[model samples]
Target: MATFTPPPTDTMRAKLLLAAREEFAAVGITGARIERIAASSSSNKAQIFHYFGSKEGLFDALYAQTLAETLALVPLDAEDLPEYAGRLHDAAVQRPWAQRLVTWYRLERGDAAPMEAVVASNAEAVAEIERAQRAGVLPRTLRPAVLLGLVVHLAAFWSETSPEFDTLVTAMMPARRRQVVVDAVAALVRR
Candidate 1:
């Protein structure tokens, strides 16, 4: 009998990313072990270093990947800020690990280079909010950047905030939590 092997490609990269994501989300970068990531991915530490250069490099790659994936999947709807916030809340709920990964990134690598994609996306969103404000759809009192930040923060409030508060909020149904996010965003942007 012959042993089988999987060819190396993006699939391997994805497996490593997924494994690393779980590890990092669970214990953060400082505490996550490359050995565990390797074992989980059916890969080895050498491959991880070869692909990402180091543990920090792997974390950077994973952070970039997570941000891009989230932006692509849960795009902002400038035409409807409340709906956009609701969708963001839904995305946070559906991919709870993603918010945790982001939390880990902030805690572990606060001084790292900003993800350019996220910066550009935020710029675009700010521009859209500005347009909406000028068109009288959204209130002009608040700065566009501030409005965007508020909506984004509202969407991830429970996940990124205090664990004790999160436990209480989690007791409510997901729909209620989502509604709260949407309502908060709506109130902020209301004329």
Candidate 2:
């Protein structure tokens, strides 16, 4: 199940979540160790089971929290999608672990039940894009969902680039990297 709410108020639960984030990011869900997470957080196995039900549950909680934090940091501006993409790229650059955690989530839980928080977040953004399109703010050539997908993917260009890509753009500054994302989205959503 997905964690749709903020993290638990209890201190132990919060610590476990914090510790699990790093552990899970480092080794991924399949390779993560409950014992290490428990010990790192100064908690124990029984406490982890009690708080999150299982390792998968702990991952869901962390992933949900991560998504919430990112959304709160850079909310969708459907009418200003280029800036939104640039902001997302900046956030990803600052919080590389968030990207790693998301990568692990997609790899490990691709077949799992839909995350309620993710579904709700994407739904809200899509609705906003639709509203913008109706008002002739965003282009209508591409579907809202597809446009959202393109913007998000473009924002992750650097993060998803290959070693060859890194070599080719070795001199690209941070500003240029972010502009690449912003410009791509602008081209896509131009009215």
Candidate 3:
């Protein structure tokens, strides 16, 4: 959505990215196959190659877009970490693939791919939290980055849980799940 360099406007490329998002999230980068992706998008391997050059290239583009959308949609609110965490939970629920893609990104890319968007976003959020702490808006108990990391992880309680944990919390409806994230962050911030 940047004016300087927006996503490719080609319809075929868009379709491929859409199809690739699901494929990568479901199977991850190593498991994703160009043939399946092409079939899903009604495109062939040649077209995908022409557009993205390779599987890794396609995955990188989609992941970058996914992260950019998250940043744009969920700007951090350091002063209100509880509500910010709740919003993040809502976003994960709305776009399940987003969370899955993040997991895949970490497992595969690791530190090899340091996304500029994520680094800048984390720096900005940490700065905001520090400012808020100095102003007495947020507690000074935890380091800004640790507090931010805690809040972010708490928001993904439902998304990152084990299968056993998932079964145990099956009855915790969406509203309650969101409230749990917000309340947990609130408790952390209170300290």
Query: Would you estimate the TM-scores of all the predictions?
Result: 0.91, 0.93, 0.89
Best by lDDT: 2
Give the per-residue lDDT digits (tens) of candidate 3, residues 49-158. Answer: 98889998898889888978987888888889999999999999999999999899899988576878778877988999999999999999999999989999999888
* lDDT tens digits by residue: candidate 2, 6-113: 545598888999999999989999999999999999879998999899999999999999999999999899879999999999999998889999999999998999
- Higher TM-score: candidate 1 or 3? 1
lDDT of candidate 1 over 33-71, digit per residue (tens): 999999999999998998999999999899888888888
How far residue 5's Cα lies from its native spot in candidate 2, in Å, is 26
Backbone collision count in every prediction? Answer: 0, 0, 0
Task: List candidate 1 segments past 4 Å from native.
Answer: 1-6, 166-171
Better of 1 and 3 by lDDT: 3
Task: Locate the minimum summed-lDDT window of 10 residues in model 2.
Answer: 3-12
In order, what lDDT does every prediction score? 0.87, 0.92, 0.90
Pick the winner on lDDT between candidates 2 and 3.
Answer: 2
